[model samples]
Target: MKIKSLITALAAGMVLSTTAVKAEGNAFRCAEGETYYMNVMVSGVEYWFPVYEMFKQAAHSMGCKTAYTGTPEYDVNKQIASFDQVLAKKPAGILVHPMNSDPFIEPINRAVESGVPVVTFAADSPNSKRISYVTSDNNREGAYAADVIAKALGGKGEYGILENPGQDNHDKRVAAFIARMAEKYPDIKLVARAASNQDPTKAYNAVLTMAQAHPDLGALFMPEANSALGAAQAAQELGGKIKVMNADVNGKILDMIKQGQVYGAINPNQGMQGYMGFMLLFLAAHPDLIDPMNDYKRASYNPMGLPVVDNGFAVVTKDNADDFYWDAYLKRRGTKGIEE
Candidate 1:
């Protein structure tokens, strides 16, 4: 019996030693004194900063470090500069939102070459060597908006497309919206298109201008939260005459819906995109779970698929606005209801 006990103890010690060795085998673990800064370069904060905030929090939860910074404007050069700055520190992974698709190719490639993992969100640089792009089905989102507007109108009338023009996701959304309108609802007329540049003030002015010019404009269609916010305010001022349907629901936008100003919004889970982007990078450092040689497993090589993950959205209307997401809305934007 004594000999048997000794053998069991020896076996347990061997197992523990092997487990320790396995744990120590990762060559890419962030050194004890090192930090894996996750650089998040997005277009602007006010519009989507909640997402970045959540990402930063998620990284902390996962025991990973991060840096969330972005240029206030949608300037590609500005975004590239942010990228360059983050790359200089040689971070563990990067979650970026390339304002311009074409300009980011070389910089993203440089990051990958330097052995840094990069993932993009909301938009993508498809031509770049980056591994993934995390965004929703933008084209589908546009198409969905088109269908909603058509059905709400019960056939057709003049409508306007609100977009940012050169942004890849906006371009795709507009194209899909128009295409769906042409194919499925041929009778619907997509009239004046306004480039709001994703700014609330610009969107407001644009919608007001278009509304004054095109008295017959039936509804406002948009894929951006800011544009939707502006359009809803305009339509509300005009007595909700034009049905406003759009994507990305913000706290203010939701209130408009409750008040019968904004008709509805396709709300995407921006938090999830950010949360996942950080995870991909954090996990990539874990060589045991992610194979370095496999391009699909690493964020650096798979950013093309990540920068635009289809973080889902749902339509919010007056009937369901109360039950929708008040708590999440308050938490994300750091605002409370008028009563609160």
Candidate 2:
């Protein structure tokens, strides 16, 4: 009896120890040299800095490595070349903001086939085999902006939109904004449209022309921050009659908001986008960690594949404009914005 009790106790101890070891081994941690890269077009833009900072923080906490790589120019071909270069290094995973949607299909599919997971953020390649997309709902952003503008204009006025036509997110914002205005706020008319192409000079020229054509332009909207700089300048020139609003903010945009030169901005939750993007990429890269009761196993698909994830957004007005400054964020973080 004594021998049997001792044997039973030993067996229980062995089972418990084995289970503990397995749990500890399965805990999320990167192996040595594991690295992820974030690739984008117009890499020098301040908008990407906060996103990358959060991405890097999440990677470091998991003991993984990360890099920021992209073309300084907005050229798609150059961005693709940079992506290919990053791929050549065989990173553990990649998070990319494709300049154009369809153009990225082949590259993103190629990466997935090569066993390197790719996740897209902000702008997405929806037709690609990229594992997931992390971004705010551009349609909602535009609809919300329309409401803000219409209410500010007392539900009846003229507004013009500056566009970046070829980009997916920008196109969605413009389309949704127009549709919402026509559907719900018919009294507010869209008088003009022009492609800013994210150029301040083009935006300046476009707004000036629109204002000249429709002197009753009570508000102007753009889908991005860079164009807002010039649009706000033109609005200022028009004696601040046009309320300039946009979808993103930089230091200058925030300053303009505080000074009431720009009405407000729809700022996406960039940090959540980055942090959740890394998590999605990591899980996609390590699919063995999950075993769901789904068709993924039989279909030979990534069980972790997510079609889209909305990180949400915030409205930045003069009251909260101080909280959205990138310089202050970088200073608090004690790190170079995107230099490293």
Candidate 3:
């Protein structure tokens, strides 16, 4: 689809409409002393920017301020330290995507105990004291990918996975996909599983190695978009026989899907995650609003419980690939929120 047509589709959804929504809202006051922060490792990754942008949008709409700060590289210790550093400044609240589940337990606990509301997004620490967790249902995403690919191949072929192990969300995706295949399509054999670390080159090399090992491999799945780029290139070079499916979408991935270089993608509603994440933190931070049922100053328990929000996802193929582009969404929304 052309950029113009995509914009029209988005406008029809009422998400954003060329300055229509932005102009009407004074709900976001940006009042003095009302600021928040988002902390995550791998801030440089393409998938994260939209989440952060929508977080900002939610903050702005709610009359608050937000800033982005986290390690540019994927280093757990560094991210933890950055979390502590952000704590010292004491923003209204924080939304963090921990590199690992247990490593973030201490920092998240300390943040909550110190009265700084915290929520986790994308990746989460279930053992931690964070007030809320927001993300797509990763298990559902993996199952959907498996269903799409297995049915596309008619359920009797070998497939492989390019995995980024240990990260909670990525691990869940891989595990769920494997389980789905085993239970529903026993005829399909999983030929290989290799580490990609969310790197394009590594994924490229991994796919090539899988191809060499299983010459009759039918398909390959990765949990994230970055690795899909490399996997797509490798599939293209291998005469496009091995179908490639992955979770998440960006411009390049959508382009590949449209061009038939890649088969499909599972697109999480990342914007909804970001927006709801901020809302969770903000409400937790300011729990002074009167409750109709409860008496004044409800104490002991934090304002918000550790709720999990599954923002949901859409399966993207060539037929609707154009609707998932960030550039078109930004243009149609009429907000200069995210940079290309």
How accurate locally, in lDDT, is each candidate? 0.72, 0.93, 0.87
Candidate 3 per-residue C-alpha lDDT over 11-65 given as tens digits, one digit per residue, 9 for 90 to 100: 7877656366677444334458788988888777667777888998888777787
**How many Å off is the CA of 23 in candidate 1?**
6.3
Candidate 1 TM-score to native: 0.78
lDDT of 2 by residue, 207-287 (tens): 999999998999988999999999999889889989998999899999999999999999999988899999999999899
Index of the highest-TM-score prediction: 2
Better of 2 and 3 by TM-score: 2
Summing lDDT over every window of 10 consecutive residues in candidate 3, give the lowest-scoring window: 289-298
lDDT of 1 by residue, 106-159 (tens): 998898777776777777788886656667788878888888889988887889
Per-candidate TM-score against the hidden true structure: 0.78, 0.93, 0.87
- Please estimate how well model 2 matches the true structure, expressed as its whole-model Cα lDDT: 0.93
Clashing pairs in 3: 28-63, 29-63
lDDT of 1: 0.72
To one decimal, what is the Cα RMSD in angstroms of model 2 from the true structure? 3.9
Model 1: runs farther than 4 Å from truth? 1-47, 286-288, 291-309, 319-340
Best by lDDT: 2
